[model samples]
Target: MLKSTTPTMVEAGTKTKKKHRTFSLNAKDKYYALLFLGPSLLILSVFVFYPMLRTLYISMFLTNTLGKTTVFNGLGNYTDLLGSPEYIASLGSTLVYVFAVTILTVGIGLLLANLASKRLPGIGVFRTLYSVTMGVSVSVAAIFWLFIFNPSTGFFALLSNMVGLPVINWLTDPTMAMWAVIITTVWMNLGFTFLILLGAISSVPTTLYEAASIEGASERRQFFKITVPMISPTLFFVSTITLIEGFKSFGLIDLITKGGPTNSTNMLVYRIYKDAFYSGNYAQASSEAIILTVIIAFFTFLQFKFLEKRVNY
Candidate 1:
């Protein structure tokens, strides 16, 4: 090495230093991050996780509301619910609605997604108009729908006259009420499901569709063979979401049906809500809530087992 001939510096006298950064938490940044996370963590623990744990605990007990003592019932509640006629009917109704809504929502959503994915004229405006319902609160939508499906002085009456259709009193008739609620629920939610599916469909490479078309695949064939496969993952996601929402359905039951017309639409969530708030059976309601959660969890696990495995990507 050669030494520099500068007046005050030789080669050994000068060196360059590189600055380095570490992941050590500084007071300001650490505090800010903690502040950002504080509310969420608090909410998760207090409102969500705590209540869930408490429900689980209560599910194991019997309580005397009059005497003010919660004794260990030890699976009695589950047995009673399993055997009781009303509880069984509620469970059945809930399941029927779940299946009905899940099928309609996914099918309609897929169709819309496919249509919108083609970028047809005026599709964006159509998408906005259709999807606005998703932003409308479920309860609010159901209340509005209840009025629409009401027998007298509502849209149903006007439509029946205009189309010469039968006057259907959906909310009052036991046979028609659940169907009306199901249709309303599906219509309100279809937009969100469509948007999700459209994202997945658009993400698929155009070259694939072009190749399929060149190979003489019809639109139906292309849909089933290419589009479905490409969006299998999104389908799985959408189906899962639909299934969860169907299981937890309460707003429609409360606002539209009120579990009414001889308990034709007694969804588990609404039953739990009514039991706790309306009937003042906190212990039983807690038990019911716990049972519903377990059923949902079990069904979800089953879905992941049989359905989730089919996801392409």
Candidate 2:
């Protein structure tokens, strides 16, 4: 049976609707959101957007030694940089450095993480020793290695003498200079990667391993099939950061090799610094900087795209 609503009931329903509408945002909530977001937007504009825009703008112009823009060259700077031998060499060196560091650092970190994940006695000491390098600053770490690489009164030298092996001049030789830079960079970055992988390993469920064991799977097989797949996401994260750090590494190269012994250790970043500050070619530097950014962005995008398919979660 249909029932007719009374005036009191209709009035009450209308009042409830009106109350809901009153509580909902009209304009004040929008204002408050904008207010809260204002500082972050402002900071991003000033630090990120502005610098990027300015660099792009500066890349198109020739600048004086006195830091004054002279003439607009359009794409001429980039075109010239693409053909320059020094730029090409620097790009090659950077690629090699980045590749080596990314692979070696992540590989070693994963190994250390796996070792640390084991529930054996004194594992904590091993973990601590592995991650202790994280506390060392880049410059400080480079200096520490520098002392060890020294030919006279150095640990490596002393060991070589004791073993009757010829001492190697790590920083002086061209081929050895790049090796020194790579070693220093990998050592400096290893701790962070180890810590990240260790956390990832710890978060994984132990039941999976037990299940695999019950199936008569060996430790090696379980590691490859279970542990590695389970931790693929963390591996992707580690690879991404390691690649970024490899590209950004300048202090170690600067301190240990100085792009030296025939520019063996000069990566794109150090090249950028040398072009801008030393050679007084701000325009060229800006162009190279933009190119480097594009390369890094391209590889980073590729990494995400390729690695995304492999990540478990």
- Per-candidate TM equals 0.83, 0.89
lDDT of 1 at 131: 72
What overall lDDT goes with each candidate model? 0.82, 0.88
- Which ten residues in a row are the worst by lDDT in model 2? 1-10
Residues 1-313 of candidate 1 have per-residue lDDT tens digits of: 0112363453223332122244455678679889999999998999999988877777777656552337888888888888899999989888889999999999988987888777778888877876777788877888788778767778988899789988988888877888997999899889899889888999989998899999999999999988898899789888888999998887777778788888888789988888877877777888788888889999888877877667675
Best by TM-score: 2
Pairs of colliding residues, candidate 1: 62-73
The TM-score of predicted model 2 comes to 0.89
How many clashes show up per model? 1, 0
How many Å off is the CA of 56 in candidate 2? Answer: 0.6
Superposed Cα RMSD, model 2: 9.3
Runs in model 2 lying further than 4 Å from the true structure: 1-26
lDDT of 1 at 80: 85
Off by over 4 Å in 1: 1-43
| Number of residue pairs clashing in candidate 1, backbone atoms closer than 3 angstroms, sequence gap of 3 or more or interchain | 1
lDDT of 1: 0.82
